[model samples]
Target: MTSPHRPASHGIPRPRVWAPLHYPGFATLFIGYSVSSLGNGMSAVAVAWLAIELAHGHGAGLLIGEAVAAYTLPGVLVALGASRVLKCLDPRLIILVDAIFRAVSLALIAGLALTDTLSPILYVSLLGCSSLFGLLGIAGDLAATTELLPSELHVAANSLNSVTSFSASIGGPAVAGVLIAALGPGLVFAIDAATYVLLAGAVLASRRYQPPTPIVKSSSAGIRDGLRALWRFPALGAITLLCVIFYGLYGPVEVAVPLYVSSVLHASASVLGGYWTVFALGATLDALGATSIQRFGLWRMTIAAVAAWGVCLIPLGFTTSAVIGFIAMSVGGLVYGPFIPLKKTIIQRSAPGELLTQVAAASGVFTVSASPVGAALGGPLVAALGARATLAFSGLATVTTALVAVAVLLAYRRRTRKLSGDR
Candidate 1:
């Protein structure tokens, strides 16, 4: 039986469920995220392909990695700055600008690839575009968490938002990979550009959510306070710390997987994209079962799923075929559903209303930082140790991290219970 204290579950239907705290604003965000995730999936595909081209075409490993750096490094530097401006701009306007800039960036990448003009100058432009996109995302996050809802539906809003990306991860890359193979990178990039157009259209259609307050603060003290709250507040701090560990392990798994397939497994490019499609589909399926996941124990299950994900990687190291690798990734993706939402809910619940965006942006910033670091380390590690050994070692590290997280959470929970009893 469920505990009396469980949050109300919104019964929508099998595979199509809702949270009781649902608001119409989340629906808008959900539509936007789904479309945006498709675009994101394509952009990521382009980046990895771009990396591969740079490394092999010019035989420069650092050059390829550097190209991708334009995408990630700026998120770390600009997250706080974005949080400050997020308070001033209309969230929708920010998203529109973000989409436009990113679409232009994709067009630039395609132009460079098509005309044979790929250059360091182009990479710098990619960096600038990525920075703008990151800021826009921070604004969207804050707007989703606080400005969108009035009466404490933060957890549900976050979960629904998660569902959108989950869906896009399933469909976008699978198709893009095929398109990239059939038509080339330019078509894939154009598809992403179209996705942004659709996303802007979706935002235009949604009616219910408007920013409740204008957040034009005179000083960015609000940004500073958000960072301070993360450290000062125990729950938010703990969740953030654990999530950092999760993402650190998760980084190489997603970012480096394509590189692994081509370089190590000797798989075709089409197969690599399909592998991600399978993984994303699994994640989507996992999200569908959120209601069941809650009753069974969210924390313990997240721990087990993540650890199992690590264990799955061990077998992936032995796989010679792309089919085997895709199967392995899909199995890992099965756990991804509950894992992401549980992590997000932990933060949304822990963060206070006023500082929600800053907290969310901080989380994004941390993820942004850890992923590249993991990839940077993984890339050379793959080059040095070979794919199988590097994967095995990464797998072990992930398991170790999960074990530490479980122990930490258990200790904290026990102490909290004791205090409650004492009171």
Candidate 2:
């Protein structure tokens, strides 16, 4: 990566922002992004809790269930369109505008909370808008990952992003839960609103960047083309299957966790938040050593993440102790970064430059797009099947991911051998 300027060191720095031989913008942007992301974590819990209250004495977990659906449903349905939007706009502009968009959406949520007469319909709309903002957020992330790092350094860059994300995740839920319980959800929203100001400031301050990939010029058909491109790879068949299982299994646990704590453990809302923080901490730990994991190999990392995540789910599902469950949750979180980064790296490394963006968006279509359906299923499954069954379902999903990924890797290996022989 070419540095436009030398990095300015500040505050117990993690990496240089700029250097002729190194890229610090990746870390800098990710750090800023992590801060905003932490605020988002807080907002999400607060929003879920607030929505539960609006459900008028229903279990707060139920509201979390619906909120998950409302937020992720759009990601599935609109990703193709979002891909097209990215095609037409500059990545930097998109990043800047998205910051504003998120800020507005967050402010709206806080405003509603403060009115003391907040309506259910209004809350739903604002929450829905936040999800749409997230759609853009993911697009911006793909752009940053592509523009900021040289291909060879993807693992290190991804590790940084994972750490930043996990750190924020660890802090957001615990803080949000406490703030909501003590001062009410409105204050959580207020804090979130301020973070947006900080987020926008960070983006605005960034050095200018634009990708070198040629434009596909098929903005209108970007989604159609993106979806169509999936057929070009047989591995995607298994990938899709794995994604369904993973999301289906895990989404319920997240949706149901708050209720499980409140009812089963007699924990306060603040305590519930702390429980989530533990889970995030586990994920952060994974990112901390991601550099070492990547040194082993991306394919190996994917397999490990899938298989370990599955086994971890078993203990997590059965554990009555929050501390024990959190320990398991942390393990699961560690597994999160390697697979995500590997997925992106694998796809980018394989595809031609101009097509990288579309391929990345295709991933969005696959991973997040399925989240709502998972959320929708989570509600009824939790209501009827119970948490253990739900947790078991997620474990099953992980097993499927591991099995399918191994199969695909073997097949790809065979294909490469055949091509080599022909040559």
Best by lDDT: 1
Q: Best-fitting candidate, measured by TM-score?
A: 2
lDDT of 1 at 109: 68
Q: Cα lDDT for residue 231, model 1?
A: 84
Cα error of candidate 2 at position 113, Å: 2.7
> Residue by residue across 248-336, what tens digits does model 2's lDDT show?
56667766676667666666877666666666776777664655565556566667787888877776456678777667666776676
- Model 1's alpha-carbon lDDT is 0.65
Alpha-carbon TM-score of each model against the true structure: 0.79, 0.81
